[model samples]
Target: MEGFTLILLYLALPSLLFSAVKQILTWRKSLGSKPQFPGPRQFPLLGRVHDLPRYSLWLKFKEWADIYGPIYYTRVIDQTFIIVSDEKIAEELLVKRGHIYSGRPQIRSLIRHKEGPTYSALMDRHDIWKAQRKWAHAAVAEAYKHHFYGHVEREMRRYLGLLLLDPSRFLDYTREYCGRVMSRLAWDDATQGRANGDSADTTLHCMSVSGPITNTITPLWHLPAFANPWYRYEVRREREQRDWWLSNFRLAKDRMRRGELPGDTWAYRYFEQVKKEGNGDLNQTEEQEVFASCMIGFLNLVGVVTISGPLKFFLMAMGLHPEWQKKAQAEIDKVCGGRMPTIQDYAALPTVRACMKETVRWRSGVPLGVPHQAERDDEYRGVKIKKGTVVLACEWALNRVPSRYPDGDHFRPERWLEPGWPTYQEPLTRYPNFREGQAMHSFGWGRRTCLGQNLVDDETFVFAAAVLWAFDLAPKVCPRTGEPIPIDTQATNSHVILEPSPYKLDIKVRNAERGGQVLEGYREVMGELRL
Candidate 1:
């Protein structure tokens, strides 16, 4: 018995020793011998986690950029932050050498889970991610060019007709219109069927699955023990809803297989093609990659969450600046010949595009570009970036940099008209938000740029032009004081995207002539759509 015990003890000791040695080796490798970047000194283990500002990390990064220069480094816990506040640095890392830097960071429970990767944005060098992005781009192109506009025109007319009947619920009607546009782009011909008094449960299921439930739930894992568990009925309900949606997606796939439902939407088409190409008998790895592609499209379709927030903000801007609305209306009237502006009329009215661009730059949809990670050791002017370090290019700061835009804090669309603006303000103009004519990093940088950029731009123009041409947006009045309440542009919230806080507005038809023009234009477009 003693001999057996001794042998067991000896084996356990060596095993423990080996684990310690392995851990030390890993720690040393991660904290490599490369010289550290010059920045705030942090505690040995904690790093600069505590030093991040209370309000906006992007603004704080701007302040640091001014002091630390463009290329700077900071650390939080075990994670390293490499901030490229300069456009030149962004181009160098994100655009020039994208192969080394355009990868996403691998988050903990966020990406590795039983339900599959919840946050597609956090995938790092997963070939599945690449396949997914490729499929997504193709799907978005098909959706915009082939599927979306018909339903969009129909929804817009429906909202306008509703407004003509009763303008009191204009805001609700607008929200519904935006929702329908997004829903149709996501679901295909089935969505049109839904508009004809059919149930939208399947359609809604497809959408609500892409909700940021993981983001909302993950923080609970960090809660202190003995505290009331944060996992509530609400969280469970959301999870169930997500599962229900995923199951419906599977059912949708089954329907496609049986030829009961055509593979019409991007999701259906991609899945159908994958099955066809893979001979309907893929290995587990290929199946995972195929699913990942569908997931990417799913997230892309839910982009309405991103757009709705900005739309609300733009609505507030119109309400606050009635004069701006009046000017926009005037431009629309002139450009459309008193008719609602079409895609054909977009280029002739440059100011409208300029205003839209300014609105996006002044208050962007995503303040922080999706976080990219270093695939290998790298340096930007001696700023050491070890492998797997998460790097973020703060577009919000880059957009607001005074050097990039003279009087950067103010909103001025005329700057876009000045030819010299591009020469002096090349960085700002190069970004998608500021230059409506060109794609920019407002969607993202490198391989992961938003696939829905073209779709969103097209829809924004159609909806915005229609809104301006049809109505005169004005501020809501205080019943007691009979005075207009103004909007706060900076009143925005951030999770993964920037969104405006909910606010009220007053909307009224421009005039009977303008209303008739809008109706006629919509009818003509609707007839073209055959809806």
Candidate 2:
């Protein structure tokens, strides 16, 4: 009887000890004694869903940042959002700990046809994402090293010609210019035919329609087509977009097969590599999807929205502030003499660069930056962030931090030239040589920083310099009142991009002779290249 009792006690002791250790580990994994980060009051279950603004959500988040400090948590329904407005905290989490914070939240709208996965900017950080990014970065770098600037220069010349012919339709010209450049790079179609434009327009329209619907009724995406008409519509649009993309890939492949591959464009290079490597991870269908996804990423996601938004704002700025325009023009004239501004003139046109930087800082198209997801539970300072929590770097708020940017609200290009200007020095460094001022957050932060920054900087500088060198942008005169049209700086349209509301501006050629010289240069370049 004593032996049996001893055996029972020993077995019970082992079970008890195992249970005790499990509990301790669970406690450590839990929130424990961490203090709740300050934020707008949340209600039961629904959280702060009711409190969030529909339009200009970034502005509301900024207001909360003012009250709650830089790092604050907001819960919307079951979704946890950690907004980081402070640059240092952003750098620490997004850069230093990028391995954990680089994950992207599941946006159902972006997952076309509920397919396995597509490699686009919208994809979360994963093995496939890593592969896609590696290939994209390499491809873009190669393109840049080759003749990317030549493509840009040709497009810009075409843009200048269009602007000269119809200055009143400047926005249309800008959109077309961006579209053509991106389409040419992606598909090797410099003409930017109806098909390219239609594909881009369709993708944009689908995003515009589906983005808000998905946010409002996320669960609806999982429902059967019979249950939700909206989901049905979304799925149908996704199929259409996919078909269009696949068709383009097929066309490119056919061209490659015929040995008539258009210039060593992005798609041409991608197809060439596919033939060379024959990567086993991707089948023919998957390869097509990846190619199409990249095209959509560059053309619709990065190119059309970002490029056009800033160009509009720059034009508006020039119209509103002629003195700065004059300053930029003076620098351009001093640097380029009679020729149109080139990439070579970038260093000499510091004031023009300042204006470009200021335009980006003043009103970024992507005010909230892209959302990143937490891969696991983590703590920042004293606050707890759970796995899958959505993190926004809050570019709108960070750019306006008064402590870092003195007179942050005002648009002053000279501030970039002043001493001790705040600079970004965390995960990545931009404009290292520009010691006078801090770099702008327009491109974004950490590993998710814009891949096209180098291209954009060169393109924007050339565009701004050429425009300023040739034209004087001024407010259009009111027909009835014969007075200058009042421009409202605050008026903006918040879509995927933050665009200034339609406003009237007059673009007059500074010198007819200079404008003719620009056209002549365009003709000469085109003639020489036989483009």
RMSD versus native structure for model 1: 8.9
Q: Model 1, residue 486: what's the lDDT?
A: 62
The CA lDDT at 204 in model 1 is 27
TM-score of each: 0.76, 0.84
Q: Residue-wise lDDT of candidate 1 within 149-203, one digit each (tens)?
A: 4555566666676666676666555555555565545443323322311112222
Best by TM-score: 2
The digit string of per-residue lDDT tens for model 2 on 1-531 reads 223434333434544355446545745776456587888886654567666765677888899999999998887655678998998888899889888887777665555411223435667665655666677777776776764747677777777766777899887777677767776777666555334544544554444422435453344444455644555776676676666666666676677677776765677777767667875232476765655555444443356566777888899988888899999898888878887887777667777877877887887777877777888988888777878888888988998888776777878887665556664332222342222236545666677766676667766777788888878899999999999999887566655466677888898878889789768766765653323
Q: How many backbone clashes does candidate 2 have?
A: 0
Q: Please count the clashing residue pairs in each candidate, in the order shown.
A: 1, 0
Clashing pairs in 2: none
